[model samples]
Each structure stands twice: as structure tokens, then as C-alpha cells.
Target: MSQTILITGGAGFIGSNFIPYFMTAHPDYKIVNLDKLTYAGNLDNLKEVENNPNYTFVKGDICDETLVNALFDKYDFTGVIHFAAESHVDNSITGPRPFINTNLLGTFNLLEAARTHWFDAPNTP
Candidate 1:
């Protein structure tokens, strides 16, 4: 059976670099990529794996608990590779709210969703 792995910020620079390499090597593994597509994120970065059979792309807000929960319930993710964040210091300084929402609160939301889906409700399926 294939394991469902979640990649947060998979559309961003570093993360986008990782996904294709990982996907190529691990054909048996499935990836669910969640990215907010902020200014730092680019779809071109993940274009190779975007339509792969073992990959899924979701554009969303991690700060929204309901959305996070819905994603968890829908995907049944096994683990998370968190990469998403408000990466630019200048952007954060100028627009701290989005940074805070995407970094701290967003991370928290992803954490909770992972906990509920991977640990707490593992038996649901």
C-alpha cells in the first residue's frame, strides 16, 4: 500500500525543489501538497509533479481550522513535511499579519490536522 504524505509549502522555493526529487525516487509514495501560493510560491516550481498520479495539489489557507480539518478528513494523510511559511523578512515586517497567520497559526492548524488525522482518527478508515 502507498503511504499518503503531506507537504506544506510545497509550492515555495526550497519545498518545490524537494518535491520533484522525492517524487521521482519514491514512486510508491503519494504526496499531498498544500500551499497558500503566496508571492513566494510558484506553480512552475511544481509543474512536473502537479499532475502525477501520486501527487495532489491544494491551494488553501492553513490558518483556517475548518479548511485544514476538511483537508485532513478528505486526504487521510499519514505524515507531514512542513515547508510553508511567510518566508520573506521584508514581507513579514511590512505585512506581519499574513506572515503570522501563515507561519505560526498556519503551522498550528496543520499540526492539529495531522494529529487528528494521523494519530487520533487513524482507525476511521
Candidate 2:
């Protein structure tokens, strides 16, 4: 059976490097890359696996709950590899809201979507 995985920030440095390796390592797994294409993320970084049948890229923000939930419903993701964040210390110091929104709320959205999708009764167990 093939597993579908949601990879947030796959256009970013670490994620862009990791996706290709993960795809090569797990051929049976499908990857759905969701990235907002922020300053830290670049599409050229993911050119390697862009054409792969098992790879998909979505240009969007992880902070959008509606989009995230819709993705969970549409893809029925079996797993998630979250890498999205605002990591520049200088930028954070200049403007912390983006960092907080992406790092905290974005993570929360992904976790909540996962929990709702994966559990029959999220509050149970």
C-alpha cells in the first residue's frame, strides 16, 4: 500500500534537500509539498523531484486552517513532515509576528488537521 505524506515548507532549504532523498528512499510513498514560497523558500530548490510522479507542490500558507483541513480531506495524508517556519533571527527581531504565526499557529494547524483526520475520535486515546 502506498502512503501519502504532507510535507510543509518543502521549498525551504532543509525540506528541499530532504524531499528528494526521502522520495528516492521510499519510492512507494507519495509526497505532497505545501509551501507558501516565502523568502526562505525557493521553487528552484525543488527542481529535482518536481517532475516525479510521486511528488506534488502546492503554493500556500500553512497558517490557513481552511486550506489545511481541505487538504487533509482531499489527500487523506497518512503522515506529515513539518518544516515550515520563519527562521531568520534578524527578521524575527525586526518583525516577530510572522515568525510566531508560522512557527506556532502553522504547526498547530497541521497538528490539528492530522489529529482530526487520523483519529476516529480525536479526544480518545
lDDT scores of the candidates, listed in order:
0.85, 0.92
lDDT of 1 by residue, 34-90 (tens): 888888889998778888999999888778799889887787777789998887788
List candidate 1 stretches off by more than 4 Å: 122-125
**lDDT of the structure predicted as candidate 2:** 0.92
lDDT, residue 23, candidate 2: 94
Winning candidate number (TM-score): 2
Each model's TM-score? 0.89, 0.93
Question: What would the TM-score be for candidate 2 when compared with the true structure?
Answer: 0.93
Quick one: RMSD of model 1? 2.1
Query: Candidate 2, residues 40-78: lDDT per residue as tens digits?
Result: 899998888999999999899999999999999888899
